[model samples]
Target: MLKIVYPICCGIDVHKNFVVATIATTDRENITTYRTKRFSTFTKDLRALALWLSNNQCVHICIESTGKYWIPIHNILEPSCQITLAHPKYVKAIRGKKTDKKDSIWIADLHKHGLVPGSFIPPADIREIRDLLRYRSKLVSFASSEKNRVQNSLTVSNIMLSSVVSDTFGKSALAILSHLLKHPDDQDFDFRPLLHGSMLKKQNDIALAIDGTINDIQAVKITLCLSHMDDIKRSYVARGTAF
Candidate 1:
């Protein structure tokens, strides 16, 4: 019987614009360093990488999980071969010169010697859902910021709407603002409807609040901000439909 050796194992160092690849062949017990390849963050580049690794008979790939940066490449390379994602926080550079090319090589060397530790990699579906949730959360944050801008505009224009209404987007408040947007100086805005419990007692103040100078520009800004909230709400609905 004859002895046979298997394929080489690879380590990849990923940067925003390029990646460095290193291959360790079992037969020679030596590392083969390849030239650096520059690639945009795109599916085509990743697919090309998969093809190259396959051509070189590389079976294992190790990469540092720099950020969400690693996921796209990780997903692409996974089915073609075994992949290990390293946590950069744990993989510190040696006390010397550090560059993307060198870092990639260093990471590959550690992986080749089985000295590197890989972090937890979530299943594909879980990672995707988490990304969507994060996006939705950011949209909600943007909506909140718009709401504050509207409140500040109203305050600047001497409208005391916030003092009585818990939310500027409440049924009565929106109705009033919607009317105000179209008719910036709509004096017929019914102040009585906005009053609640003891707020009814402050009818005088409520009337005075509305009685303040309603600047035309401030009114337009508030309406636009509120309209943006509507758009954000619609996006949230679309996100729910996607899941």
Candidate 2:
């Protein structure tokens, strides 16, 4: 019972490999005409689809957002048409007799009658910023995970480094750790060279902290953890310099 608002419009069901497009046009007598076509999702084919729509005088386009498959199509057709990016949940047809062709037809019918609601599509610059933030968040999470792994390796080896130093990865702490990992069996080791300024005041406490038992296995694991931490640190610095 809905009135036809767009006399000429297109609906596209997007997929990874291909897309099914349905163009609906209404005549002066209110009789509707539908032309269905299949096109590959490649760049040239998308251009062909856009050209076909333009030839049919299709101005308004309704395309269901199916994963990221709809992006390329939208980008290609955006300049020439008024695009309505419909959310799949709202545009999805009922289950029983569904096909990609039928889905395209259903979307066209809904859009032609002004029954489809468009989803919010952010501008390109905002989308780029959002993607950058997401990537940065992922990198930060990975760096935190590597830090936890380093702490876990120290804890399992019964090393009190974390308890003694506020930042175990600090210069003084890493120096002491490197010395201990190098001469883990040398009980008569001196902590003087590794101690500096404020840390030198806590020389006795640091000596006690480094006195914890560390087997060959723990030494190897800690060495690998420190190496991985260094890699993460360098990566973080590089990313910072990029922005």
Candidate 3:
């Protein structure tokens, strides 16, 4: 027979709206008893669950990592319980006979015999940093997408600014683009004043590039893309400052 590890332990089957918990208590006779309960995912009910576990003296707790549903429960019980977060595959219930109560009971029985292997959870501060970095990465991706949209708008509008400049979003390119956007109808306007440093040498090529016409619809699309890119840049900077 498997040796008893945690003589008294609890297992929680977490869900988005509710959770099923089972507490297993083993006696000197090697027989185990289970008390199962259902609780909502709300903060108050989770606190109540923590209190119930404390009352039963079940400090060792095991739970399956079901998406992000288990985070709130972990946050509520971390202070008083030694939580063991296991992958669902490690404690999954029998197929075709699966139920929340049965899942919790199975988890509790496994944990009672030290059969559950816990996943590695970083410290709270490290998790916070990880979340911030992930959000920043998403912002970067969004900004890149907006930039691509702007490039597509320019290309479809017959503007070839990208062919003449190394970075179409550079200061000199932006100046020329702003000028072209402001005067969509007048292509003969001198662009020399907009050129900077090495861009001055490409005045003739830049002029040929900006000679393309932009329709009202393309102009609006490009404007919106630029505005969204600017907003994303500001948000990224603000989040970096916070970090």
| TM-score for each predicted model, relative to the true structure | 0.79, 0.85, 0.95
Q: Regarding TM-score, does 2 or 3 come out ahead? A: 3
Best by TM-score: 3
lDDT of each model, Cα atoms only? Answer: 0.72, 0.86, 0.91
Q: Considering TM-score, which of the candidate structures 1 and 3 is the better prediction for this target?
A: 3
For 51-157, candidate 1 gives per-residue lDDT tens digits of 87888888678888876677778888888888888877656678787877777666656676666677777788888888888888888899999999998998887
Runs off by more than 4 Å, candidate 2: 181-188, 213-229, 239-242
lDDT of 1: 0.72
lDDT of 2 by residue, 1-243 (tens): 568999999889999999999999988777888999999999999999999998999989999999889999988998899999999887889788899899999899989989889998888788878888888788678767777876787787677878878898888998877887888877668878877668878877877777676788877877887787677678778877553
Which regions in candidate 1 have their CA more than 4 angstroms from the true location? 1-8, 27-45, 95-101, 188-205
Q: Rank the candidates by TM-score, best first.
A: 3, 2, 1
C-alpha RMSD (angstroms) for model 2: 2.5
